[model samples]
Target chain A: MPYELYYWDGIQGRGEFVRLALEEAGADYIDVCRGPASEGQGIYAMMAVMKSKSEAHIPLAPPFLKDDDLIISHVANILMYLGPKLDLTPEDQGARHVVHGLQLTITDLVAEVHDTHHPIATSKYYEEQKEEAKARAAEFIDNRMPKFLGYFERVLRQNPKGPAHIFGDRLTYVDLSLFQVFEGLRYAFPRATAHLPTQYPHLAALHDAVAKRPNIARYLQSERRIPFNEDGIFRHYPELDKNAA
Target chain B: MPYELYYWDGIQGRGEFVRLALEEAGADYIDVCRGPASEGQGIYAMMAVMKSKSEAHIPLAPPFLKDDDLIISHVANILMYLGPKLDLTPEDQGARHVVHGLQLTITDLVAEVHDTHHPIATSKYYEEQKEEAKARAAEFIDNRMPKFLGYFERVLRQNPKGPAHIFGDRLTYVDLSLFQVFEGLRYAFPRATAHLPTQYPHLAALHDAVAKRPNIARYLQSERRIPFNEDGIFRHYPELDKNAA
Candidate 1:
């Protein structure tokens, strides 16, 4: 059976990570919320799962997947489940765990990226938190971003198989997710990541390789790929982008 | 052979999640960094694994587990690896995934808690960002904390196995982690969580139950249980606690 994905319809948000995996694997899946409510594939359908009394596993938020009777949530956890089934992870047990660990770290970096715009609270408007966001973005660009990106670069360099991929020579879901991170960072903080090609050469190369992949290339050019916007986790604010260079 | 757990020497931090599992399961393990450096079991030992070129999996941060040749990092990933081996997770595959999802949610909450004091930057001192910290704390108390706690409460209510535990009737590592979260919140934001007994009764009950467990009770009183301080993830700051009520 084709997988069913539940997420907000408007923006990519965290759902994009899961979407990247599904798109790259060319898996048969439905973007449930993007469909109409008349066909039982809209926000209501997603809310049904969220508010479902019968669901043994209630997802805290969207970007959850349903395959057969199994429903799983959390970006890293969902990717971990999909990775093996879709052949996006290493087969060995230890290697699998390593990939999972990398994914979780990526999850951490994404959360930090979200905080750049919504440092005070997600419930409030960005206008209310603009000043704090500027300060937060400064720290993120100066310290946290480099720290996280550098760690990933080191991991790629240390990968025994080759630096071409995060794990073995074959691409894993992590490599795809890293590419998304690179894409998002560039969109969100162009000046901040202007030197990424030299600073994070391996990640830049991986991003290029993943972008050139047949499936991902088609998905990127297709309407399926959502454009980055202010409403998304990675947002571009001119004032906050200052000092990023 | 006994597993080697590596984390910072002084504070509980994220490593406490892994330690709670080892303590509750009565598994043979070493708190590697807590031991003396002379015996190659201090921060140096932990750094060796992280910096080692020979190690197949280099941890992004501390709180990684070293089991013979295999090294796994990230709190939830480490617990997922240890959960099955230590028999802390539910037996069924679907149920196991549910527990993992819950653990990842808990991880999200912990990261937010860390941000309450360090909303602007982790590299900067709390004093440097005191105003931002206060604003962040207000939002955390008013919105984020309640949202996360309520979600878990709904999960407990929806659990087919009863509300005594998060999953089945038995205690999983998630329950232990929740107990720690409760403890940390109570310590860090006493005013914010003062009414937790009435608000999050299931979590309160779970915390109580876990605390009374023979092993957990001992662990709590022993030196192994590091007290919450400014150096750790959950820090008690009087200024940040304002208006929490």
Candidate 2:
């Protein structure tokens, strides 16, 4: 049976990290929520799984993978489970832990990115929290972004197997997720990340390398790749895209 | 050699989650940063590991576990790594993933709790973001808290084995983390959580059960359990603790 992946129908959000991994590995999987409701595979279908009291392991939110019997939740958790199966992780156990840590760091960064726009409340509209968003975005551009990205850059630099990828010499799920982060940041804060290549050369190169991968290259150009918009986590608002000091 | 856990010395912060598991299992581990500086263990010692260029697996922040040569970061990741060793997880692989997912959900709630006090920026003081914090906290109390706590309550209610524990018939690290979350929420928002026992009886019962565990009871009264303060994630700011509507 094809692996079933459930997330929000629109926008990449956290699901894209998992999608990218699947796409890169050419894994057979169904984007369940994106399918038509007529076939019983849409948002309602996804909700059925979450709302099922009979299900022993119902996930709180989406981007969960259903492989036969097991239902894995959380983006990082799903990726960690899929990594070994997809061969996107190293064979060594210790190295796999480090890679998992990197994915969790990405998870932290992604949450921060979501907060940049919705600083006050997820229920409130962006216009309602525009002033607070501006402040949060400025701080994100100046402090949080650099700290997270720089840490990744340092990791890439310090990799004993060379700085080609985030870990070891080949592509891991961390590299794919970092590629999504780089893309999201650039799309969200064009002016702030205008000098990304100059400032964080290692991350920029890693992004470039992932973008050029045969499968990832095709995935990016396909209709499956959703465009960044105000509805998504990394929404671009010109007012919130101030250049970093 | 004993397991070495590295985190900031004063406040429990994220490290307390790991500390709870260690204490409950009666596992021999060193709270490295909490030790006296003369003993080659303190904040400086923690920083040395984070700042070490020679170490390939440097964690971005603390509350990391150094089990011999392996360094595992992030609260959920650390607990997931230690859960099996401490026998805090179920023997079934699928149940283990479910428990890890629950822990990751706790990780999300904890991050949201931190954001209540620091809506604008972590670098900025609470005074600087009091207004935003109030707005955020109100939402957290009204929306986020109920949603998260409600989900966990349902999980317990829906447990097949029993609602005595989160998974199977045993107490996993998730229960311990949830216990910490319950304590933190009560400490941070006493007025807001005044009806916690009435509203989330399952969780309340679980909390009471975990607290009564011999090792845990002793650990809570011991000096090792740091008192909640303004320095930690769940800060008690009266201005941000408006009662739920």
lDDT of 2 at A111: 96
Candidate 1 ranges beyond 4 A from true positions: A243-245, B242-245
Q: List-wise, what DockQ does each model earn?
A: 0.74, 0.82
Best by DockQ: 2
Q: On residues B1-245, what C-alpha lDDT tens digit does candidate 1 reach at each position?
A: 99999999889999999999999988999999888878888888888778877655587788889888888989999999999898999888777777999999999999999999999988889899988899899999998898999999888888888898999888899999999999999989888888999988888898899999999999999999988888999999988784444
lDDT of 1 by residue, A63-104 (tens): 888988888989888899999888999899787888999999
The superposed Cα distance between candidate 1 and the true structure at residue A205, in angstroms, equals 1.1
Kindly report the docking quality category of candidate 2.
high
| TM-score (second chain) of model 1 | 0.97
Model 1 chain A — which ten-residue stretch has the worst lDDT?
A236-245
Q: What is the interface RMSD of each candidate, in Å?
A: 1.4, 1.0
Query: How well is each residue in B194-233 modelled by candidate 2, as lDDT tens digits?
Result: 9999999999999999999999999999999999999999
